[model samples]
Target: MINLDGALYPWRFRLVIAVLLGMVGVIAWRIVDLHVFDHDFLKAHGDARSVRHIPIPAHRGLITDRNGEPLAVSTPVITLWGNPKELMRQRQQWPALAAALGQDAEVLSRRLQQNAGREFLYLARGLTPEQGDAVLAHKIPGVYSLEEFRRFYPAGEVTAHMVGFTDIDDQGREGVELAFEQWLAGVPGQREVLKDRRGRLIKDVGVARNAKPGRELALSIDLRLQYLAHRELRNALVENKAKAGSLVILDVQTGEVLAMVNHPTYNPNNKRNLQPQAMRNRALIDVFEPGSTVKPISMLAALQSGRWQPTDTVEVYPHSLRIGRFTIRDVSRGGGPVLDLAGILIRSSNVGISKIAFDIGGESIYRVMQQVGLGQDTGLGFPGEQVGNLPNHRKWPQAETATLSYGYGLSVTAMQLVHAYATIANNGRMVPLSLARVDQPANSTQVVPEEVAKTVQGMLQQVVEAPGGAHRAQVPGYHVAGKSGTARKTSAGSKGYQQNAYRSLFAGFGPASAPRLAAVVVIDEPGGEGYYGGLVSAPVFSKVMAGALRLMNIAPDNLPPPLPEQQQAGALPGNGGRG
Candidate 1:
């Protein structure tokens, strides 16, 4: 007590007291500001850590055939996602999580490290509902799932080229899917959701938008006919060892494509081993010389120009006609000295047709072909429909004109050839083809006189009815009129033609008295015993047409009577002439 008074000064004591009071005042102001003035900002920060804006996926549209049979549909699936930072924090759980996901733990760890800065990552996609539930039941931290729709094609490879397919993110990639994507993919919605620390959704706060489901699409394809065409084309491809093939069937009266199929197809559902070549729609995309198939059209042009008549006869002696430096020969050697229009088509005489083309000039032939939809689109609006090449005839030489008359020096698609044949079946009226059903019958323009069409039809009938015609294309209960074609394939990237490669084609209409269906079959590079259109492609036409006619319940007009025993005992005419 005696030293305490000397140890302290009055000014120094007052200064120390003032410093303590200042410190206390500052602490009080800071406490009030944190608890009241900035309270809303602090609360918002806390909420941001747990709240999320989640997506609500909308269901895609259903795709159906003309009869309302489902071709493509969507099914609900789950996709598992995770927060990389949180997922990596649980190192012990990595092995278990990887096991559930069918992944290796070391790979999973590496993936997490690669995505360290990412808040969300896909753990797995396209999981079934049951599988998703099993994964969630494990209560793994940072793992969550979202509901999504996956496309399912019921027809598989049967309708692969027509229906096409979607991608993992539900976007259309090919075929009709890619063509009508906007009309099929719907709008997605959003919602505010509260998430737990492990990224699991706890509760939905409120809706931000409502999802609008896509509208259903109905195609003009008849599933039954599609199946029939697909089966026949596949069988022919396998039997003939063909590199590829396509078949198109059209309703003659309405110009609607009843069926379209291509070979070298793939299952759109399983895309693990899908190749780009397998996805091509050969019927509309591939172009080939029509070969002798154009003879009917050329004959029609001659008939239209009034320069030729059905009863007109042309001498085909030596079975070959010389044009400049080129020679056009008939497939039947030493058979025709003089042939009427009927016999010319029945024999598929190159010389007879070339002589006619020389008389009418190339402009008339080109006009007739153009009117029949050659060198033009089919108006199907398919993704890759090609408008084939048709050269101008103004500068044509005799040889070029001759070749053009018999379907060379020009190209046409399978669909275009089918359209031309359908025009003939529709009594010379050109109707626009459709891939979707029309409420009313399409308008038709008269491309050829009715009399000319009738005459051509009768002449074509002789092709199947005559003793040495396309007998393989004959339907037992009906009269079939068709032309067979065998054109050597032009070598790609070269000027000359391939020695062995050929495109076997058949184009025809059925029920001569009252035609209804027009079909075309194309077998590319058949490598088997036969490669001619009559030998390799006509049989396909006969079988498919028989099924199609019976399916549609068309009346039989030319059912053959039972042959006499003596005639039946003789060998049937071989399908070896012309084509």
Candidate 2:
């Protein structure tokens, strides 16, 4: 007011310019943050309003036999999902959607009304191909169809216990499926599909991410052998009227599982009809006291210890062995004055074998058993495999050693017993057992001397040829070495054995010259006139062995060519050299 001039005017203008500059700088900094530094946070603002997400499922893989025969496969399936939040906003329109989808309106209304805040919820899984098409045709705002896979068992119950089944979500749930889930399940992929404001599909933006299918699996089971074994086991169970039965055939040279069969089986595809026990894999999971089949193992120990020879004679008491408070006895009295070691096997004399065990003592026998992979897992990659019970020497009572000597006090699974016998058949070499074949290197440990194994193998042969033994186990064209077992099922609380309840077993291998396959058949509670292993299990061995031999096309050793009718006349006499 006192001095008005041009300089004062310019200074006042400069202050106003400075204030305007500060406001512009603040706005520019905020613009940089929102558009550049915090761009993702700003973009998230539009997610709820403009973006739509969908799930993509990966394809499950196929499980096949070594020869490419399908065991497990996946068929095309569809799943229905809904966004509850979107559906609830149009609750009144649910009836229209329900009618178009051919579902009950009341049910759809209830599902849509449940917790309006839910973003994703499954409506139905594993829909039939036709039903899936109908759901897609509806084109409802919240409902969608996703392509998926469903497990199918082509071999049905024949391969169920080995291949196993998947859960509803196509995840491995049991058997090989669960055991090799990492290898069997594929990696899932994702895609982004743009939608308009009205929820109508628009053009694709870019390339889609493809899912990787699961890796294919090849198993060691042979289809022909598996079928034959299953058929025989089912018929045998019905004929014997037994509670249950199981059989396994192993390649003694390769340790590959040729066949595995269990009775009271259920179709994995039709799981609704399955019973609790029908699903059990008895061959690998269940353990029982293997009566006389265990005799061969003890014989190996005895021979290895040089305490007994194949022909060495030992007098067997007619009835029972009184050891402390317990007594071991034979089913029937042996007919000879004194039984040789070979005679003891032929007659299955419990008393004589127990004496052999007594000579070898508990320590040597236990060491051999452990070395041959008893009282432990078989490492076959089976689920729920039991490690059989073998009481320690320190825990054994005065009578335990004698009873165990005759295969009473110890327990073993069918696979374990088979492997032990296969070790003997392989000339004392312990091959790592395999269910699936690969190029893995072989590892072996000597369980017994080669001489000892040969001696035991020879003695086991007489069990099938001699009288009062398992003659039915003998194949006409093939020489066989095997042992029969019959053990009474022990009762609870140590009250002694149960009457008429027995586990009958026949374990053997054939061609005797060069052992090939070792097989075992276990029949539980065969309530019939003949409850012995010779009667119940030997015939199964014959059938399985004959089939296995024929399947492999192995020529029988030392067999002459068939003679013509005219040439047959000279073959019956000492003129047999004339052919």
Candidate 3:
């Protein structure tokens, strides 16, 4: 029955066959276009949707002290980011996301809306690994985390001013961080990565650029000494109720800054409440009149002029010297009516020192001070270092000269004072100061004659060892040489000085026989019962020097003899009168 071959096929059947064949041809054409002719273009288009070029962050360098202890380091952290458009689409989940991110919902919403057009917006800059993990565990869409670094100061405020700190973006903002930003910041790399629709990383396609890590930096600061200085200075500040203070320790031979500390320092790691004043490196920035500490320098000038000998005597009867409407009085009441050269320094007699300065002339004293690196930067290359104010010798009147001899009419930084004392310790050669480790000893220029330095150092030893000298400055077993200074704080605009405010200063070196360390301690505006440098600052020197000498293994030169009956009964030497 089906044998009717050649019977005409239905029109519907033919139409159906033609339609099927056309569909096959179109499918074949599409396959060829996608897999052969336009493969690269189509693949690129697909990649553009799912693949991303992300930056690979490089780590910053480490800052270490001279002994290889880390002062500043970069620690890995996570930063949360979001695609504003994608995040907005999941607005209902915002409360949960904001809770996980520790942000207010309204604040998060406003921030997202403000940056709605941005493909990348930071939700939180620095986050702990646990925090980032907690956010990711929520599985909120469009939220992403990136690896980053946060600066950590291991020494905290102990070395804060010296090592400084970085900003959230890893840029150095202060201290050594700002000074060596170029060397500390590294280059970032780029890599192409494939991501899923939910913005989860799938696979790394390829690396475009390799990241370069920063180089390491080694500073000259000895952490042990730095800690010691910080502890002592902080204690002194608390005890004296001083407004602020600074302490600097220098290597007498090498000119390396072993320790530099400032009071009222802030923690660099947590700078949320950091004040501008707390961040200042007061040792190098703040300047003040050096007061009676400069007596030795004036004596040095007098001796160098061939006009005064170690045995020379001066009569400061009534303890006052009148010069051109200015009266210089001795702090000593009864014992300073007459004194020898060593007695003058031991007693800290302002009138006696003034008499010698008048004999030597102002130019000689100014010349000696200038030669000792006063009124100049200490060559530390620190940011905002002040050169201080030393008036020209030609501008000095007779009264000004008398004041200059007693360390008034001029200003000096704590660092400059340390440098000057270090020069004396180095036997008159002024070495360039450094904050970084140096391979070789720095070159020095002779400021004072070697004999003059030795003689002055000997006289300074008397200032610490004499019966009425700075007995507080004496280390238990080490011979110490230093001078104490107490100067009235000058008012901001007026020529007159503040009545009660004073700057207590002590400068000296330890192991006096062969000086190894020279240090300076300045307590600003001490509001305690005793404001004299000998009473306030000298004790700090004694403690710090004792520790430093022991740490350095320097042999002590003096051993105290057994105390007499009176001394054993709690009566210490140099406790009778003001220095």
**Top candidate (lDDT):** 3
lDDT of 1: 0.89
Q: Give per-residue CA lDDT, model 2, range 1-579, as digits (tens).
A: 676654769888788889999999999998999898988877787655566655567777788876789999888888888888888777777887777566799987877777577777787778888988787776667887788889989899998887888988888877888888888898877666677775656745443667788998887788888998998888777888899988998888778887888887888887777797988889888888999888888877888888777778877765577886667777768667588888888888888888887777877677788877778778877888888898777644546666777787788998888888888898998888776754553677777899889888888888887787789898878889899999889886776788779999999888788998899999989976787899999998889888988888877863667899877886667675644
Query: By TM-score, is 2 or 3 better?
Result: 2
The model with the greatest TM-score is 2
- Candidate 3: stretches off by over 4 Å: 1-52, 194-203, 334-336, 393-395, 560-579
- Per-prediction CA RMSD (Å): 8.4, 4.6, 9.7
Error of 3 at 264 (Å): 1.2
Model 3 weakest 10-residue run by lDDT: 1-10
User: How does model 2 fare in lDDT?
Assistant: 0.82
lDDT of 1 by residue, 1-579 (tens): 376642567777777888999999889888888788978777788789988888899988999998899999999999999888887788788888888888888888999989988889999999999988888888887898999999999999999998899999999989989989999999999988998786667898999888888889888888999999999988999999999999999999888888999999999999999999999999999999989999999999999999887889998888987766777888875445998888888888998898898899988899899999998877878898899998885576888888989999999999999999999988999888887776688899999889998889988888887888888999978888989999999989989899999999999989888999999999999999999899999999999999999999998877667889777666366534453
Give the Cα RMSD of candidate 3: 9.7
lDDT against the true structure, per candidate, is 0.89, 0.82, 0.91
- The alpha-carbon root-mean-square deviation between model 2 and the true structure, to one decimal in Å, is 4.6
Mark the regions of model 2 whose C-alpha exceeds 4 Å error after superposition.
Answer: 1-23, 29-53, 89-105, 196-203, 395-398, 439-441, 492-495, 558-579
